[model samples]
Target: MPAEEHPMIGVLLNGRTLRGIRRGSTQHEALQLYEHAAARLGCRICYFRLRDISLRRRQVKAIIPDGPVGRYVTRMIPIPSVIHNRAIHLTRRAQARLGRLHHLRYYIYNRHTRYSKWFIHQLLSKHPDIVPHLPETRQATPTAIHQMMERYDTLIIKPSNGSIGRGIMKLFKDGGRWHLQYRTAGMERTLRTRRGKRSKRRIRTRRWAVISFRSKLPAALKRLIRQRRFLVQQHIPLACYMERPFDLRVSVQKGDSGSWQVTGIVGKAAPAKLFLTNVAQGGTVYTLEHLLAANPSLHPERVRAEVERLALLIADHLDRHLPNLADLGLDIGITQLGFPMFIECNCRDLRYSFLEGGLWEEWAAVYYQPISYGQRIWLDRQVTSGTAN
Candidate 1:
């Protein structure tokens, strides 16, 4: 099929990503991977922002590829009915635009990427199978925090809308005193290389502080929770790798047949003594097999099978309950006894762990899955409307 004649699928991006593309920067996103994946799947992709669409005209000024070149050109095209929304727009006006698009009968998967963590926990709580895996969670009220602290020796207090392990705190009791450990916002320092080629990088050195007090919650911690919506959950004693706590980031996504699939699983080990295993927070990525091998008690085959089953079940359950969800990154923690514990769910999964873990095959497939899934939806609609090419 000719490139121009292939079915067009939309890749909705955030304003930052659109501007980055316009500025010839693809750092914030892997635009090349998306382009390559679309090409491999025999589909044409249009990259556009929500504001680029004109609802009245039903057209979008989207960026499309030029013939045999890596360059892109802007052109007007009908609003693609099949849109994969990768942006998280929190403003009401932005949300209104999304609602309007849906009203216009656009097929937008992952229409709402961000969801309240507390809300999702409640949704999963209703399910019996999931309940066993869920860590006890509650809205971050003073009473809830106090009561939960009494039940568990350690608790995690984090913002409901947080991502990449930012704004997370660890509360634990030891030696007749309670300790609060959290990362403080620190300045970024850039190091220059021996060669004169200067490059900027965020300083990996994180400043973590520990505060201690007796019995009652610290005024500082209490004030922090009051500032925004937060969730206090029981801290799962995650099984460790090299004696450092780690968690598995499972990429569950829709495949070409529009069915949920476990695309990849990678282990993220936290920095020494840190409570976070988020990649952005300097966590080291390792192959899931390697992590399981280090923890000898867990049977490799049994643990692998259990993780897959649990990931699929969660994805399927969330798909039925949530609206238009096709991709999810679940942070699943395993106990020393190999029990899978659901830590957190990320709607926008940044899939660097696969690449970092040297799983090139899975890394490539993560990029291919979304476009392939989009192609599936577009073809299904075409068949239904008798417009198949």
Candidate 2:
């Protein structure tokens, strides 16, 4: 390839981390993480503050588009060979800019689509094989929540566009009482509880603790225009390894053979009794095999094939529904009966961290290349059909 054609992979990160995530005057230890990964792939990462950047056509063209050669030479200007979306927060301006880019291969942790969670679940629901693994879910409204509570006493409320275990609530029956538990910072509190054992009752506050689809949905949609909506799901009894509720994260990547490969399996274990297992929320990570060995009762050997099956199932779903998706970070969990269930999938989730743990070689296959070879075919189709425009 000519010097000018040497695939320019531009990483658009928030400007807050140009030199990497810093504190006051000290560089964060985590900064090295992104830098090392970017160095390995020879990526020219540019951190742009989306709030400062607008979607105005003139501004977008000035910052992103190439010269006249890129504009008129091709009906659809070829996108940069690789666009690493490291954006933490999304604004309308950023979404508009991303929508205008026609020719680049871009990978986002989250998409710019409205009702993204609904779209993702819709695609996942279409897979017959995966249907059994997915927990029964529906849009949460005050009425729907009441209906779900009738069947299953416990329900997990999650912000559709949330990450790292923020804004998650668990409502369930505890002995003689109904309780609503949520997290703020790292500490947890039972914000409200309906009359239970009077002796154990501790704090009584005047704060109104209510979960409503009627109010939250509109506010969430506007507040997180770049993020997806919230989801209310039936809580699954996740398989436990080492006395902690364990969830499996299967990172899948597209291979040169045009098939999906299992990059790595990370078993996320929540600190005892917690309903969620996110690393950001005091969770521990372990290898799939190790966790299985510790929990003989889970009978992972019998379900191993199912894990691989779901990985491929998710890859196909992303390729079909979200045409721009190049890779998927699949969150899967196993119940006490050793039944595999789908938790979530993200397009921008990273795998290099798995590599640091010596999990598997597929980590290199997924993150090292930045863009999947198969996605190029989709890009070509988008250009030819003018859908990417």
Candidate 3:
């Protein structure tokens, strides 16, 4: 088959320093995996930054790997049939540029926010099957916080647009006193003596701190609410291993069959004394088998089945409402009683978690699955335009 005849797929990234298209060092492995998949599927995969696109020319300068050395060579290629977005956040200018190319299809759509949490909650609250799996979440207000604290012993406060477990706080009532444990940004000062000269060095870090409040919310917590919108959720009592709470990260993606499937599911455990189980926040990932083996009391088969089922349900529901949603990562908390609670859904999930866990095969599947989906989209477009034989 000719190169142009093969379906073209583009991976969109965030970096803008490059003149045309180039893959960052971090994306090297992903580029190789995509190349492997393209060869197997007889498609063309290219990596392009948003700035590399020219709407007037209907072309993009895409980075194509040369050979085994993985040297990237740039070439001006026609706009791809579909784009797989890997950018963390899209700026307004980028969005406008992409909007101009309305003909190009995008697999993964927009980023999900805490407001999306409230929207999903409202949508699923009426469903008996889904409502039980969701925690009570609302826009954080003084009145809402007080009411939620009264109903549940513990409540979680999270930023509306936060990721990687940043800006999350746990508020709980301890007898007559209220306690809050949250991660805060602090600078660590280190004195160094070099070449007979002493110097002071400061490094920024996120440190966890605990505060006690009496009869009222702390002024710090109140100020945070005023600064940004937050989501207040009833904290679920999660199942633990070695006395540290853990949750399941289930990734669901659109497969070649055009259906949502659970691509990878792993247990994420936070370090001792920490509440968030995000891998970025000093958490560790464990395979399902190892996690289940550690907790013999939990039913491995049943929990796995329920997690996959709920993940698919959530994915399908969101796909129906939101167009161009190709994949999502769901943070599900399984209670000690084996009940699963919906934590949050991430649109732009990090693939490194799977890679770090040595699940390279699974990671490759996730990296290439979008390409397969894009081929299908291209075929459908051909048929719609009466060009297919």
Candidate 4:
């Protein structure tokens, strides 16, 4: 902890990611992104978890990324003025702890990252400009589902806090019958006689299936909806590439000047047989330019402009309600006629999709943007308090 060192920006990860950093084996989040960003942005990175904070001492045992990759130094330093939250805090206790930190005058941007899908929809519904871009959404009650089915041929049922396309159900009615498409994770099997059996063996899983109902909504589906909070939305027909439906993942963030900007956009196409276009669920990523080139009918310039406009509008509107919503990954769909439709909003964006799409510069910019934004917050806090950052 040298005073001569550059100002530090804290990165708060979950316990598992913190341990992986100690072992130098974390794969999901590329630690090198921060290393390179530090060199370019002139701000060091301080990696810590909630448990690492010591309020009584007013300091934290933060990991400083120094030397080569997979190398760092641990020091008991005063908590950085700015923090970027990378962890999902779902429990009541976890949230209260974050609140405690906030009360201590810490600039924790994107601290409350996990907003429910239904909550976001409700907020955006009030904005006239953003309403047409949003699909029709309702709580997943049996009565609501029946009412929606009467109006729209297809609907989407998804968990309020789901991610990566998990816990999503697609429902469509055809020929006076209702069909549902969903996926199940690999099923588990138990072997009582472990001495003579393979206890780890599992049934073939991670496959998609469809169930049909003739006259009424299935009882099991109703029970599932009641067991957990779900939201139903009218399914928007998405533009297709290679005969498969696709959507865009737009990366929006506040830059050095604290203004929202669209940093990158990548195309996510559903698998040949699957309906969800999440990369975790057998989806493929393509550059927007490449996708537009393959589909000759889409006007690239118009589509790009509209997408940026909608993304910024959504970001600005959400920031008014959500505190410090500086970074977001929005899932927006495009119709055959080239209109941007809202799908979902992710507070803490995983920028890997840009890397997968082969947009190297955009991918790097995604990492560097946060550093620049954090620096802005740090500078502003100092000016407001008449002290150093």
User: What are the lDDT scores of the predictions, listed in order?
Assistant: 0.87, 0.57, 0.76, 0.88
Q: On residues 198-244, what C-alpha lDDT tens digit does candidate 2 reach at each position? A: 34434533222443332233343234333545677889888887678
Name model 3 segments beyond 4 Å from true. Answer: 16-24, 27-29, 103-116, 123-128, 188-193, 196-202, 386-389
State the lDDT at 195 in candidate 2.
Answer: 52
Ranking by lDDT: 4, 1, 3, 2
- Candidate that would win on TM-score: 4
TM-score list, all predictions: 0.93, 0.68, 0.90, 0.95
- For every candidate, C-alpha RMSD to the true structure in Å: 3.5, 10.5, 3.1, 2.1
**lDDT assessment of candidate 1:** 0.87
Model 2: ten consecutive residues of lowest lDDT:
68-77
TM-score of candidate 4 versus the correct structure, residues matched by position: 0.95
* Distance from true location, Cα of 60 in model 4, Å: 0.6
Local lDDT at 219 for model 4: 84
Residue-by-residue lDDT tens digits, candidate 1, 1-389: 67555778898998888878867785547777888898788898989999999999999999987666468899998888889898998999999999998887788889988988998899898889999999999999889988997899999999998998999999998997889898887777776778856668657556899999887778887888888998999999999998899999999999898999999999999999887998888899999889999999999788877888889999999999988899898999998899999988888888778888999888888888989998988888888884432
Query: Model 1, clash count?
Result: 0
Which wins on TM-score, candidate 2 or candidate 4? 4
Candidate 2 global CA lDDT score: 0.57
- Model 1 RMSD in Å is 3.5
Residue 21 displacement (Å), model 4? 1.4
TM-score of structure candidate 3: 0.90
Q: Per-residue lDDT tens digits of candidate 3, residues 213-291? A: 8758888888999999888999999999878898988889886787888998878888998888888888988777777
Q: Provide backbone clash counts, one per model.
A: 0, 6, 0, 0
**C-alpha lDDT of candidate 4 relative to the true structure:** 0.88
